[model samples]
Target chain A: MTTGEPGACVLGVDSGGSGLRAALVVPRELRRPDPVRSPEPVRTGPRGIDAAHFMAQLLPMARGLLEKAGGGHITAVAVGAAGLATLGDDLRAELPSALAKALGVRRTALAADAVTAYAGALGDRPGAVVAAGTGMIAIGTDLTAWHRADGWGHLLGDCGGGAWIGRAGLEAAMRAHDGRRGGSRALLARAEAVFGPPAGLPGQLYPRTDRPAVLASFAPDVAACAADDPVADGILRAAARHIAEAAAAVCPSTETSADTSADTCEVAFTGGLFRLGEPLLAPLREEVAAQLPHARPVPAAGDPLDGALHIAAEIAAGRLRLPLDSRMLSVHGEGVTS
Target chain B: MTTGEPGACVLGVDSGGSGLRAALVVPRELRRPDPVRSPEPVRTGPRGIDAAHFMAQLLPMARGLLEKAGGGHITAVAVGAAGLATLGDDLRAELPSALAKALGVRRTALAADAVTAYAGALGDRPGAVVAAGTGMIAIGTDLTAWHRADGWGHLLGDCGGGAWIGRAGLEAAMRAHDGRRGGSRALLARAEAVFGPPAGLPGQLYPRTDRPAVLASFAPDVAACAADDPVADGILRAAARHIAEAAAAVCPSTETSADTSADTCEVAFTGGLFRLGEPLLAPLREEVAAQLPHARPVPAAGDPLDGALHIAAEIAAGRLRLPLDSRMLSVHGEGVTS
Candidate 1:
């Protein structure tokens, strides 16, 4: 059901390095804001972005979202982003203002992708949400606040993410080169085919700079390699452990307590990485269960976009709150927190 | 490094699924044989068996020559093996009647891991040797044969080594149970904490098996997933191309051709799968050149046993022969002509 005319149309945006996405949430009770009813996703170049540049890309998308809403009166906008976003009055303001200006909202609430995702899934409740995309971040919410662990990215960390698996696959290739390991030749050849001559590998690393998708594209190769190849299997296993670790780290801050085995909020996962399904999720679920014996795992109802829309609805109703509890409101969508 | 009386030395035997290998060669040489003084390698495996497994393992300790020297003249023994060498074959049929009976010999030939290694590194000659340790094979020759290229195993393919990289890795983890495209959290958790459970994962997978190490043990991970992680950088770049392909597909009758380019056998590499070398010797060397261009990638001296020894003296005598063209031979290793 639409928030009704002059209906409070709220915009939700998820900005990533590759592109910026904006959705017009009209408060649907069944499923997410309709994809067909929504505006076509706007495409934008990833480079040359710092504040102003970020705004330029987002504003147009915001306008598109508005246009696609069939001229409804927009009340407010909420943005969930890949980078850090903390809202406060002092210096080192964490809330993402770059997106705020584009949305034309002075009071744009902000949260890290992890927190927003948890908000989207659990609705500001005490639960854990794992964002398994090109990168990985696990967010957990308790009664008062939220907590996180393991969002280090491809290089420093990011155990069970698309990027980590892809990078690991490439490393296996190099190990093969040095004669220290073994694997299928097809994997490396594919890497070379995609990245370019192995000789000039270093120079080719940053051709696109801000684009994580370039590297994320290799995740399938890692999954494929892991299926039959021991080396690839190891990489996937490591990624699972990393993601599980993040989930575990946040469990303490969730409804689960160290004193008792019962968890306050069940765990949930979102994004493409989780879509890898059994190979990754089964092990990950097992690992998480082993670590937090009392914690229960629930499949994510929808993606970050879906979560974003829920948050927009909450904001529109002035019911927006942090670390939502199940009692706060009803969730209506596929894979919503139980 | 002689261990006993001249006529009472232990034999070194290297039996592979491929063939039978025996050497009156002493066990001391199996650990650290004096290459300069080692005897030439011999081959007497069954029809299906060839130098691949038999030669790869035993030749290192100079088994062939000692066999020709006779086992009655030897004492204690050391041995290496492959496949069911540990269980399958009935000793009565697999071994020669005389040797199996041990009528006159104090000890029969032992496992020829050294010899097997030598075959890959030194082939029939003598010199430096290395290996990727998987189905991928890479042999090179200076005076003897040195080997490299994803060795023939599993499928008729090579890009890098590490059987698990493509087929084996995926199979081990069962492709993370994603129905052709996914990841396994359990497998990933097990692999990440190969040494022990990292701070985050639960201990469930640990109970199932020593999965972490088992999965990590595969080489393909190094090649496929290490691009972003320094731990796997060189590993991903490793593995060079093979000089030949099996067309006729007959036992030993397979016609082989080398992709001899501007860089012929003048520079090459040999191993199970090179750590940082992959796809082709050309691109691998080129990658190496990214750091040290002029550095010649001379083929491995031999498979490490008497491979180089077998050919070193022959080359010195200007009569060392190769089944493939000299240029192709230079690129790969001295081939065993039927």
Candidate 2:
């Protein structure tokens, strides 16, 4: 079952509101230096939900990945899901159990989607990390502990998350429709181009099932418009400020020594939002840096899937611990087949 | 009908989104320094709309006032409305001519609710004022010039307006209902208290006919909660700041003299909101004063209706002029009356 290897193997999956990602690994090495079996990325969803629904999508995704991998060597599975807070502990526990039932395997663990993303970016390090995915959330650790601020979904806050960008883009489009905005031909054209034949735009956005992806698709156009458009720039600046606030909120509440460079922490980027490169990230980085001058933006080594696998390995090796360090993650995925 | 006297008489009516108030006025020199006419306060339901409805209410009220006056002559009629804005010439042209028609008179004039209040307070002097009535708005003006900001209505801005207070209070109630905030008993009790033996509290609030009044009733409770309730204080403070912003927007633009009293151009308070006295007004007045030292707050001259009448006299005298000074609002009202 173990591929005749002495070390243990466990799988980790980060099921987000937008997509599901899977990572498989050997407990002794968590680093994903190779692309083979290290942390294979697979995009699946109809999004995640409160714990019960999270487990539902997750278990099937895990089983499919396990089936494809020839199953025998897996010791445990860990799932990271979005909306875990809303579900509270009751549903979280039930979800882990539900996953085991669905996969016909008894071993499983669960944590916040944010925690996993933090693990991916910081490798269990204490510094804070925000997952600006379809929804934005900030999670951090002061080495001894962790805290979160403003991840209350789209209706409440999310801030610099993908959904916000998408919503902003859509609003810009609507403003164009109503002739309130000065000009947005580029945005209009992009929307028209997306809803080919043009007539279906309303149905696609208002009623169609693919609204999230459809909206997410608009983020790029918004980024493109940001430099040339004042309105777009305003929106991006606001988003960046919001995310920076989130990061600041989660950071340790204390004053440190004068050597800020050493005292400052990394503000890692993970999720589709970071892909916009500097157009979006630069402002966000600037905002966070303005507040926490010592903090620097570090690109995620890979993504949350990698961190999930790294964490899974830690658990298998009996080295599972909180305040995971970046060094542990750096080496954890090296031996896994990418 | 002149009663063989050089003294003038003016009728001032204050109309809001929901009600109408008419005041019979005898200018300061003609009677006791206080200008209010006893009894017959001039009221009408939901008659804040057209000339016809207004006439229906006004004729009776006017007749009663005249009858009470032992057949004194009427010199001029001045009217001020809450919802009406001084929308420059273009928007003003679009306003229904029915307003003049409703008063059932050859002379009719209109002015901003804020201006009316300003005139009532400063009597054609140059200064600024922050009015938080059913909704919040701030307007300031030098005698011949004016500036305004943030009266974008309930959904857009309103800020410290009564409606804003009510909405914040409602939100607090909802938070308490959902267990997000504890001990909102005062808000709930106040809400229930206002609805009266209202076929029950919920019944009165939900009944289509009573919803507007029921909702309006919450604004006072919001202020009441501010003294001790954190949630209530948060709402009031935010609103106060919003109102302050509105006042600040006009401060630089206002006209004033170097030797004028320090509080001259500083923001002043009027409207029902100030009736809550210092608790609410102090913070609002301070915030605005902090921003614009000259942003003074003066007590209103009884009501905007007085200002309206004052303006009506000036208009009848052919003193109608452009860029009317808000201080001489009575003069402004008179100038526009014809």
Candidate 3:
């Protein structure tokens, strides 16, 4: 119900580490314009993702994009937030009414960034996608159900993720400093250069609110030292194995899916972690090949923002095939049926 | 310095989890009374252990104990602080002057609890002692120098400590919850019983300042499940291996020590972690035996407070033989010539 071309379109919003992005897309269109983006990441609190903070950032970006595109009826809206699974309650509860009131949007899909990564990677297909950055998560669908692995945060899981590798590398550095076994001289040198002396790392790290991000910052250092350091190399290899384990854990097995019609599914990798190149990816590829023989690795088609756009368009077209998961992926409002 | 029956005694203070304790100890005496105790763990801050909070707890307690002991010359003071190795700067810089001003103390030994445990276990003799509680550390002496391993706090190290076992057990529980490989149903049951649900464990942890202690609290649950759960058993065994590794790393090797006269040395295990009993200690013993064959395992002679007393006694008698280490153990008084 806008002033533009009376054509059906949907709004997509993604909130993640870098910032917030909102895009409008026409369903079934071959080409789409660049999304309006804001560099401010939404804040999270005890209540979860701050719904008010999110709207404060989103409304302007959405309106700006909509006005520029001369938008028509925004049939549905979907938002993908980084911590939607564990910390999205505030957003999930408040976003629908807020969106409908602000933009006359009735249909809303609140999806975890990993779920959006999955949709964007495989397009409602029965497959798995791993989005690994400071933290890592794998989401796979069997069409009827979704399987998830890791994303348990740096302490519990997120194994083989950026934080994990950095922690391992730093541990090796500390070991070297302590003259203990498993110490890596090269890694130790890198650690000293990056974080100052190994002795101060715990004090510098443990007290921080952004510990995961801080730990992940060192992952690249670990990767950089792999060529000359066995300890660093071993850390990367172990990370690869762990990542593969998560992938294998979540990928739909041929013998164990509601729809066993497909024996294999395409697996995709996304996120900043993969940018470390072959030091991490090469072993990751080997591990994935060894662990999930039935799955093939593929390049990710888009990012979480694009995934949000895709989900919104699917909802608008009444062709959203992804099963609704209460926490992982959910649809709100009675105005939409798919 | 005290109005007692012409005897030499020292004030030994232990600042740890349970609380603060001060004892007027007559070194080399076979019999000793219980230490005056205050149920207050000293606070830590950006500058490290709050020197003010520490003296507030120690001053009255030390005075009362000295008065109770019928007034004797407080020959020396040795404070074994739990975080002395890393967070002891304020305590080191401030405690000497504070103790001198308050208690007429001159000699002071500021030691990490691990060093205190080592002294309590092996005295000033050459050997290694593993102190594993919520965290773990191994300290050894070759007469001329001290060797430290692990004790890098839970994030970087403290492998095989209570926190490590608990974290591993919880990881298994999460694995079971996610239906992933390496799942432990027994651990899952225990985790849910203790932490409510495997899903909520991350939120329950990660945010707290006392994360290590909270993680370690689950160690007993893990220990209880070890008898029936291979996963739990494996976690403990791995912890044992890590502990052994640390011990091995720090224990003086016949081939590497400056003083190679001793063919073998005594090794002792200390702390609440050892109280987990055979479920953990049995494997730990096996791992230690395998790794530190040259060092014979021995029961600790006393607790850390006793160790503090011992260090104070040594300092007072001018017989302190533990090599000075800037962080591990530091002597901070000109009157001390040991």
Candidate 4:
């Protein structure tokens, strides 16, 4: 609860619509002289909700991690949450205070989950990151300024994300039902088994259901059927184009850049949809190359939690300068002056 | 409330997401020997809601119509309603009884709004009709069977409807906000004027708002700006393609037809989007023609109420044999035998 030893340990948390993940590690060890000597993080359960119920799950998880770590002084805690975008200005302003009250720590930081993904992908470097999971968004930073594309939720955007892919699959299935499109026999049978008869799809989707999650559940089926199913392949190709376009929107084109260092836009990919591997990445790489010739895909250095930990370390070292609004960053229940 | 006198008059109603339109006409006059002698319908207020609240508005409207029509004997009442597709089979089964109870009529017919549009456009002929208003759907028939495409609501489908156009415009506006896309200055200003700023749009749309209506409201702006705004033009082009694709999906291809009569597919377009006239129709016709070379656009003979009246007249004369299941048809709360 108190401000523990200065250079001791830090807690990093990543919370999303599905659940929460947290890790505890030594701040100094994260930047260890020898990469092999870096201490392994203590991982825990997935236990969180949207921003509304964030504290309810987060407080206990933080306390549990502190208790389990035993003896070490917890220096700071950094959290990246899925629902941060919905909080708006007032809630964002109060976030540090809320975290301070719950974790009982004087040093804390908060950011959107996308930020953590970006940090995990590129560290403090200037590059673009496309995160496509239940939702999709692209974030690019030239160190001095940041740009965002899409991630406008399932209704308006998230064109190439899991939900988008699933929606495409469902539409194709419906088309197949009407004999409008082929390659839906397997998809239709699978959908019927998972939900109900094709006639009941509208009832299952609209008004009452947790639409994003339900639609996202269909993404895997689309991927599975992509090999033999022309419809699924078409969806994947379209998704790749959308994702690439989103990335291109955020990442600077090589032709426009004056600085040679910033000329090559190193892009990174993350989230559940990427786990589909070659089916998605093969076309996605082609799309990125076609759309942004200078952009190159790089493997992510760590996950969002690791990014959270990295941010926590930077905050402790007084080296963190967020390319965000002052109001977007809070420390110990107060705004941080950049 | 009595079954009145048979073959006296018939009431036909069309209900949509925004409002309802009804007409009262004599069935015998609908089949007048001289086409010029057909009596014009008695029109009333546009009074209806989505399927959930349909009866609340519909019952009163029906009562008011009967009261206004006074001495005329109501032979039959036929209704075509929006959101009918979302209703499960059980609810559809119970609709006739509910309608009968409300109107105090034994002979009643019910169908989805698209069916009425199709009937109005094609007039019992074997052809396709695409209705693109607040929502979009294509209905096609080969005399023996029916085919439907899209109309999956604003969330999943309604691909080329007013809502779809509006959504595309809104997305373009948001993309402009993020500097991801161009040609949205006028669109953004217009949106801000109507919806009170771009940042607040997500809050206004998701969870709480009447999303379809709100999105559809933007279509007019998109149509208005299409000539000058690249973003608006892009939206219109995409909408045209989607609409054509949907129509093509339902309409039988020229190559597959063994019957020479079916080779030339006559297509009729209806709904508010078509009211945009040439901006929509020109591109839509081109796309439809390109995709469906055999299909030609036709001017609708009458509106959905006329179609409903046509069905009512057929029912009064005992000449109506629906291509639907017998259980779907009821006469005075009793199932009809084909």
Candidate 5:
């Protein structure tokens, strides 16, 4: 509690379908008004680490980060994992202790990646955050309640995510091959450049073990072709509309809201899809505005790593107030209510 | 070649994602006005049999059927298999000889399931056939040209198929769980009845080896709830529209066609989705009419097995005028030009 005293450090991990990243930082560094520039992570790799082996996969990454921070006293360790939503309440409750023990930290926090993303984007404020990477979900809080929409996964949902865009691109490529409308020649060329002949697509797609990543890899091509390709542009617009709908779905209805602040909900966007910049953000903002006229577009104050570190700092000071169902555990594996 | 010979027999096989069926019949019996009543198949099992192992799986079934037919001189063996479209021309060409050797037949024919479905539905007449089972595709022949649309697979296409409906139902279930709109209480209840709890859906869906089958199992519930459930009704209507679109996409345009038959293209619907009957068919007819006014809905004249037998008979009589690329082979493995 000495406000980032020497050797007082915290570890934050953001693990998703696309990649795993862990950052170690002093708590005081997160107090700035602007977004915290995340320290270079000690370990990073392509994601889709199985939920069953999440703790096992994460422990080493946390350990590596702690080691890199030079034998410091870890105040807290926080993990925001993509598949965390699938874990039941009991499993979620058990995770804090497991993470505490694995990281050799006095305190630990675990949450769905969307929760951390919301916190990272809006901090302690009440608003909505739409995170679209390999998958997509929208999480929002109206101070009293939390709402979530979509992020179901590639097969069932994740409609506006990077993987979804990539899939749409691939479908357009195939349609072009069949001389169907709604396909772009540029998109087909881009796909052929990456995966060779379009005929080889099934070989590359069907039998591959890491299908999410393979599909998501096509997203960049979709973004790159958005300037001139109608198919790619259409895919992007549809994705933006979906993301906007997701945000509107999670945000409290303005008509029924008793809170005066609810008239204008702050909405923030994050994730790899946004890296396409205005090609994504412009349509996203427009659609969000169209759907929720009172939606005020705000740049995400930070990324999930920053959110994790902020939670870690708050947990260390016993000041964390999360609307999410979260538990903290001490090094001795005893639950600590925040 | 013999006509109505005592020993003249043809084997017809219909292999789809759900099951495989084989029947042996004399060619003369198939020339009846009514559809041939296929004899009980000797082998049946779940589909998704690999292309590489297609012969391995089919041989036993064909042999069993041949034995059941009681030592008749096998004239031809024709197979309509799911996933056949994904196989290359060379592999498809090779299938004729492979089947001929395995069945001790003089002629063999191999086609995508939709092709046989079309042949079965209209009996070589100029028209389109929309097949929506575990997957969906439309194959149409104007007698001079062949057209195909959709049936890309569960991931990229198959928009109106059982898998698609099942996926939509699951999404609605998840939406209901998240307290979002567009979820039917009945749909959720039906889903929980089969899969236990909604919370376990992602676990059941993501890691499963037979995802398509699992997804398809939900289609019946969607059909059952169509009358009372808005979500179910919407799903069914959308499916019908997609199926209609696919049919229209594959049919020849009336304006440009030199043949007057193009002005009134006959459209036949087949597969498990149609088993829902009017709840599925009514909207399908409406959508087809909306998309292609000249489209005429026709009851299927026969099943895929009958279509295979028809082809076999034609091959034996040297009267088959198939628009498709087909090859015949004798037991000695020499390619016999059609």
Candidate 6:
């Protein structure tokens, strides 16, 4: 896994829903550098991801990281970005050349954040990674091709994600306020305390551009109330089922025969949603076990930045093998063939 | 409700999700005028409804309607607007004065579209009206006060509404595409036919300002597939149950005591969603029958435009009996008192 010339460095960046972060790594030395972080996330526009805004935040951080690594020869750059599959056309079209010119790098990889998450969690191994943060997506690979499920953004999908859980909790709260069936008084009190009167929630929410994040902010409150509230617990259980379903959908089948019941697969859960603790995890664990009985659940070895670094190092070493999707993952410059 | 002076009229406008509609009513003769409609919906902004945008569309339409009515004296104007309950501050403060100054009106009544739909369906009678178009809401009164359930917009509640049903159908389609549980092949085929590749639906839908309407537009497709698809049937059934729940929540109690189920509230259905016909209404009928056995279901008497006209005529007649909530239903100028 460690392949680079002595005194050589590579850049890794993760531009995601929450923020932008970059790290510099000397792959030959096998030491992971601390990521330089920015609270600001890259902007999106009519064409999807704004390339100029991404570069504005990234170039400076990439430069600072390189300098902090003691002026090493920067050999490669890899970026894992949110919205990269559907919204990364502009980034893919421009970023490789942009980085090559600005940072004097010869190798670069542009990847969907999900792909990087897969790399981070399982490190090029054949497996599925369910990354649940402000949004949720499940990604998998059988070594030759990639598979994905449920990352269709907040409006169309992203079921079982943080926003989904928060929105479900809020719906139950509003239902209670209206005296409808399937309501919870605990969730209602929590919603009122967190977002004011239930009547005002629509006004507070519908107009916002950043609605997913705003919705996700309440997921913790939902988790907090899950222990005592059947409604809250139900919401989490439904979310857990969705998560496991997504995992099972993307997990590679291991049956050597068509009719075989036995199989083997690697499954891992990663990201901010796992931080909700046992109220969410206990049910998630049960659902995953029930739905993906043949798959083994494992811990994520690293974050997306680490995945970015892994891809960069692998590209530098001529050993990257996680498949090259035009939209999901692409290699550029001298590293295009390997 | 015929009390306007001879050669005098009242203006009625409905600014809703789909369009802007206005009518000039001759209450003295009890004649219903043909409505003038603009396809453009009023714009909303940070401060809620754009008063200037609303006035720009309304003033000219009002003046023209008045002129077409033989240059009649416009005594009052009643506007039934979407978002009026929550986003009508600018409209409430500025609309009355603007209409008064421009038209020399003495009376005005402004109401939420739900209220107008109620007025249109039952004509200020003691009953419940369920308005279901792109959004759904249940409103009821026992001749004393107003109660509402589930008009929380596309992102929140709007349970059993067109958007909700459409969203559920699309979710199933996506599940099918992803090879997840609860997937429906019929819905997948319908979704692919209507929206093209399932993978690109998020790009097609998420960026639009008219997301709810866009989602609602697919409701018929779901309905079309319901007869042959259990998934679609399940979605419709769930939606019907939600509709009944909302109706029951808002329906006024007629129980003489706490233990009696002998309620006599009349319930009526109105709006675009009902046009889905038996696929939706068939189950909705069963659900209403099961949930509100004592409540009677009645056919809608008129549309929201008719409701607006009725409100205007009632205001001119000085006989509007619907309770005057400051937000839900408001009376201005000379008609402030019954």
What's the true lDDT of residue A297 in model 3? 93
| Candidate 2 lDDT, B1-338, residue by residue in tens | 12123444456666665466665554443441233332332232333234445455666676676566555545566566654433223213422243334433334456767777766676656666767676666666654466665554442345577766775576455334322323265665665566543113332343244333345568778778778777777777776776676666666443353324434564566778767655577677667667666554656654677666655555545543324433223322222432
The DockQ assigned to candidate 5 is 0.39
* Residue-by-residue lDDT tens digits, candidate 1, B194-251: 4243321222222233332333354555444444433343333443322221100110
Q: State the displacement of the C-alpha of residue B275, model 2, in Å, after optimal TM-score superposition.
A: 7.1
- Greater TM-score among 2 and 5 belongs to 5
Candidate 5 lDDT over residue span A1-338, tens digit each: 24345777776767654466767775445442221222332232233333335565566666665565456767676677666655434435555666656555777777677878887898767778998888888888775667788888887778779888999999888777655556678988988899988756875687777787788889989999998887898899998888887888888666654465556788999877789777777888789878878788899988987787667776666566566453211222235744
Candidate 2 root-mean-square deviation in Å = 12.8
Question: Where does the lowest 10-residue lDDT sum fall in candidate 5 chain A?
Answer: A35-44
Q: lDDT of each structure?
A: 0.46, 0.56, 0.84, 0.69, 0.71, 0.86
Ranking by lDDT: 6, 3, 5, 4, 2, 1
Ten contiguous residues minimizing lDDT sum, candidate 6 chain B: B254-263
Q: CA shift at B167, candidate 5, in angstroms?
A: 1.9
Number of the predicted model whose lDDT against the real structure is largest? 6
TM-score of 6: 0.94
Once superposed on the true structure, which residue ranges of model 3 sit more than 4 Å away at CA?
A1-5, A26-29, A71-73, A255-261, B1-5, B26-29, B254-261
Model 1 ranges off by over 4 Å: A1-6, A27-31, A34-49, A85-106, A174-179, A182-215, A225-227, A253-264, A323-338, B1-338
Off by over 4 Å in 5: A1-6, A17-20, A27-71, A87-104, A143-145, A176-200, A225-231, A252-264, A324-335, B1-6, B27-70, B88-103, B179-186, B229-231, B253-263, B326-335
Report residue A273 deviation for candidate 3 (angstroms): 1.6
TM-score of chain A of each: 0.75, 0.73, 0.93, 0.83, 0.80, 0.94
Residue pairs whose backbone atoms clash in candidate 5: none
User: Quick one: best DockQ, which candidate?
Assistant: 6
As a whole number from 0 to 100, the lDDT of residue B261 in candidate 2 is: 40
> For candidate 2, lDDT tens digit of each residue in A1-338?
12124544577776654466665664344354332221323322223245555454555555565565455456666566554443334444354455445544334545677777887888855576878866777777665555666554442345567767766666555445433323265665666676653223543454344444566777777888888877667677877887787777666533542223345676776777778767787787678778767566677765777777666656555455555322112112223221
- DockQ of candidates 1 onward, in order? 0.02, 0.03, 0.68, 0.35, 0.39, 0.77
TM-score for all models, in order of appearance = 0.46, 0.49, 0.94, 0.82, 0.83, 0.94
Candidate 3 lDDT over residue span B1-338, tens digit each: 12123567787788887788877875345666788888678888988899999899888887777677776667689988887878888998898988888877778999888888888888877888899998889888887788888888887899899999888888888888877778899998988998897778888997788888888999999999999989999999999988888888888876656566778877889988989989988998898888887888888988888888888877766677888888878887866543
The docking category that best describes candidate 3 is medium
lDDT tens digits, residue span B228-304, model 4: 88778878888898888788887855565434566588888887788877777778878987888878789988777
Provide the lDDT at B55 for model 1: 32
